[model samples]
Each structure stands twice: as C-alpha cells, then as structure tokens.
Target chain A: EADIYQTPRYLVIGTGKKITLECSQTMGHDKMYWYQQDPGMELHLIHYSYGVNSTEKGDLSSESTVSRIRTEHFPLTLESARPSHTSQYLCASSEKTGIPSEAFFGQGTRLTVV
Target chain B: DQQVKQNSPSLSVQEGRISILNCDYTNSMFDYFLWYKKYPAEGPTFLISISSIKDKNEDGRFTVFLNKSAKHLSLHIVPSQPGDSAVYFCAANFQGGSEKLVFGKGTKLTVNP
Candidate 1:
C-alpha cells in the first residue's frame, strides 16, 4: 500500500551521540513535514519540504536538520542528541491542493536520549 | 503561544452515548480545520474536516461543526464505541500557499464499555 514510512520505530541512545531518522513515502507527494511531539501533548512542526531540494524550517526552532534528496525520501539528522530531544518524531506528506488537505503520516519514531 | 487550544485534557463517555470534543482557535486567518485520531504507537489518522465557509460536515459516525464567529469547532461522535477511545487533535490551516497547520493540544477521549 502507498504510505509514509519511518525507520527505527524505537531508539535509545546515549546523549551527545549523532543519530539520523529516516522517512520515506511511496505516494509521491510534493509536500512533506516533520513534527516533534511528547506523549499526550501538542505536535510541533520542526521542518518541512515543498519538493526535492526545497526544505524550510517550521514554527518550532529545532536543533536537528533535514534534507530532501529525492521526492520519496526526507531524512532528519541530529548532530548531538540531548536528553531533551527524547520525544516522538512524526513524518507526514500531503498534496498541495484541496481544502484541509489530508496528510498521511508514518508510524513515528520514538527517541530516547539518556 | 498556542494558536489552537483544546481546553479539556481528557474526557470520558459511556458507550452508546454522545461524545463531544471541542477546540478553539485564536487566529482568524485559519480557513480550514481538521480532526485526527491517534492510537498508541501509531501516527494520527484523518477523521474529518470542515472549511470555514461551511458550518458542518459529516462522515459516517463522525461530524465536525465549525463556528467561524466564535473561532470554535467541535467533533461529535454518536453512540460511542470502545474502539473510539484515543487521542484526538484539532488542526487549522490558512488558505495561502504555505498551508502550514497549527495544531491544538490533543484531548484524550475514553469510551467506557
């Protein structure tokens, strides 16, 4: 089935270690987004890409960075992980048109920095 | 500051009863709104949506009501089922090209059987 996918559904790493979270979609969507969320809390958008090679920061200021090399892949990298970075990272994709365009989301990556 | 707000952190409803979830927004620029349902260890799934121009929209047992003047919206689920227990988030987006969404703190709904 065509859907968004995120690797490393669960991760536990020491603080200050470098880590990368992978996200890919098979629907060929032009718009993709990354969001950070705490359990039972609001989701905060951290990064987004309009298309391949076009990336932008979202409302939240994040230490992590993202790249859109191909239309299907948008990966996020954290140079130095911290305990505060322990949260769920969600990846989503959507079409450009339509009112309230529905976004398809991946299962999400739960990171634990200790 | 939180642009969207879901005041009730959690709610409980008995099975076969009506369950109402409310959301309020401060930004009038938002013209489109959506509701998403999320379960443990899974990403949120789109439930329903409504445009600012429309007052209500319905799909199956899910219905979304929007009140532009009050900058408020609500989701009503009739005859709540145990499977309906999950966290529901309300999100809003503007009409411009960016289309970035502002989301509210989710409300956890528990349907007791």
Candidate 2:
C-alpha cells in the first residue's frame, strides 16, 4: 500500500480565510504532485515538484501555492479562500527511475469555501 | 481543447460480465497511458498502464489495449465484481518529455451484483 497521507479529509471555511492542506508520504519519491477535481470533472493538475526546491505550475492555473521543502512533505496553501476554490485536492507521488511508473495517491482533502 | 477525453460518462455491467471503458486522446505526443480507479471522496488509485510501444497490457483480471493509429485505448475487466464499481480516469503523458499527466473527465463504472 502507498504511504501517502493528506490531512483535513474535509474542511469548510468562510470566505477570505487562509488555509493550508498538508500532504506527506513515507515513501521516498522524487516526484510529487497536487491535483484539483470538481464534481463530474476531470482531475486537473495544479502544482508539481520534481524534488526539493523544484516546484512547477501545472496545466491548470490555480490560486493556491505549494512548497516542497522536504522530500516527504508537500503542502498546498490558499491565501484567501473563495467559494470557487471548493473542490477535492489530491496528492500523488512517483519514483524517478529508469522507466516511468504509476503514481500512488493519497486519500485526498475536500475543501469547501463557504 | 482537452488533450484526453472519456466520452462515456458512466458504464453499467452485470456481475461476472465483461466491462469495457474507452478513452481517446488528441495529443499524439503522449506515449504513456494509465488508468486509475477512485471512490467517492477518495483519491484515484493506480489501476493499470500501457506504453505506446505495446498494443496490449494485462494484469490479472484487467487488460488495457492501446491503438496508436486511432489514438484510442480501452480498459477491459472480466467477471466484474461489485467492488469494482468506481470512477475510472484515463491519464496520459509524454514519457520522454514532461512529467505532467493529462487526465480525462472520467467514467463511473457500476457493477451490479
């Protein structure tokens, strides 16, 4: 089983509130990613990190920011939450090696900005 | 334009029957494809994957067939079980280029027991 974990399985906060969603993985993976998904929509990549101090924006433009200071931890933060930010955030990781492999995902964090 | 597309919004199959889910991609540069299973309020789990070099890949009860010429792929599950009911997402990326994986809208599979 994958060792990835995401905190705050469900969160509901008022508008303009700042919040941080924590994600960590016990597995030593070089690549980490954050994806956002809405109901009946595809999972869109928002942020990704190749390694520590190497973060890149994903295909989808997001108002959130992420930091990869540790190999095992990647956190996503929203400075000012809005109702539009309500969605499920998923964290995933994969090893960087000879061949591309499948990524293991955490349970995910559901954020609701009321 | 969406790079990947899962035209079917949902699929239903009876128990012990075969269930097939299809996916199409617009980007020819994508050489790697993957299928992920997800439950409600949970993250997607890696189910199976296929490389462009090969046309077919099978693992246990699941099989993935890729057609490069048609830019289409399919996932087939035999003897479908109720536990297999979940949302399946098709993802693709350039294996030799970028690490970003593009995903489709996903197809919810319902296995009736």
Candidate 3:
C-alpha cells in the first residue's frame, strides 16, 4: 500500500555491468532519499534530494549517483557494479512541510553483483 | 561513531506480554524521536513518534517514551501478539535543518505464542 515504488525487487548482475535503479513516488513529495542497508546492519544514507534540481551525497560515501529531474522520480545509478555494491537499496519520500520529515519507504531493491 | 544505538540485537517475548525495546542517542541536537517496524524484505514502517516537548507518546498498544536528559528512548508494546514480531528501529532528527532521520541499528523482536 506504500505509494513509493522501486523496480527490480531482486537483481543479480555480473560485475562491471552498468545498472540503474528506478524509484518513483506518486505522493508528490519534495524530499527523496536513497538508503543502503546490509543484512543485520544499520541503514546508511547514500543520497538525497531536497527537490527537483537539488541533489546531494549523504553521510555514507558511495560510488553510486542519483538524479531528481522531477518531483516524483529519483533514480540511482551505478556506472560499474562491483561485489561491494551488493546490498539492499531502499527508496523513501517525505513531505518537507513538517518539522520532522517522517519518511515513507518502498520495498527495497535487493541487488547482488557477482 | 554511531550517534544512535540499539544495544540489544534481539529480544523474545511471550504472547500477550509487554515488550520493551530500548534505544539511546548521543546527539543532543536531536529533538524528535521516531520508531519504525520492519518485516523481512520490506521497508521500515512508521510505528510511533515523540516530540521533544513530551516524555511519552502513545498509539494504541504501542507507546514511546523519550528521556531527553538521558538521551534515551524506549518503545513499549502491551499485550504483544505474534503479529508484533519484527525489527524495530529508533530514529532521531532535529528541527533547524532538513529533518533527515538518523536511524539506529535496530532490534529484532520475536513474540512467541
């Protein structure tokens, strides 16, 4: 029932392959974030966008890049996938109007690079 | 350094029992706390939240207590059921900024029937 959506719920690809993970929300939220979580590990903010034409790298240093061309879409891309890139990528969106931006997440995309 | 920590990795409770999950934060700037529950293979869902102004916030069987002085918070689930079994995460954020949530590692709770 979550409005946010991530494509390729599960993906297994060879190393050196380029891939793009698509995330879209219908809620028209101005804030979008991409978090990376490994099994039994804390979630790490990889990238975020305040609004269209505004994007920044998060606390965690990641080789991935993200772009937000429209309010409803935020796509993360890896120019070259590696074994270290295997992890669960979660997409979330929140409204900026509140004091605390409580996020709504989409079912994560589990990626495995072999 | 981990600003937020959930010391216990896992907890087990019997059905209909009260389940208590603990969280601690080191950042004084965090003024709001939130709890999220996640099932396997799914994203975390917002369970409950508390503002800096209140010590306690309740939603049905779930209650969150924030002790700002101790930099700690706890989530209580009374009469816990099997369906309540999930990984719970504690998150915190401040007001002056963009309000990005800093999440703890999470504690996995198992409710035995």
Which is the leading candidate under lDDT? 2
Q: lDDT (CA) for every model shown? A: 0.93, 0.95, 0.94
Q: List the candidates' TM-scores in order.
A: 0.97, 0.98, 0.98
lDDT of 2 by residue, A7-90 (tens): 999999999999999999999999999999999999999999999998999989999999999999999999999999999999
DockQ for each model:
0.70, 0.78, 0.79
RMSD of each: 1.1, 0.8, 0.8
The lDDT-based order of candidates, best leading, equals 2, 3, 1
Return whichever of 1 and 2 wins on lDDT: 2
TM-score of the A chain in candidate 3: the value is: 0.97
What's the C-alpha lDDT at position A63 in model 3? 100
Candidate 3 residue B86 Cα shift, in angstroms, is 0.8
What DockQ does candidate 2 have relative to the true complex?
0.78
For candidate 1, give the docking quality class from DockQ: medium
Per-residue C-alpha lDDT of model 2 across residues B1-113, encoded as one tens digit per residue: 89999999999999999999999999999999999999999899999999999999999999999999999999999989999999999999886766678899999999998
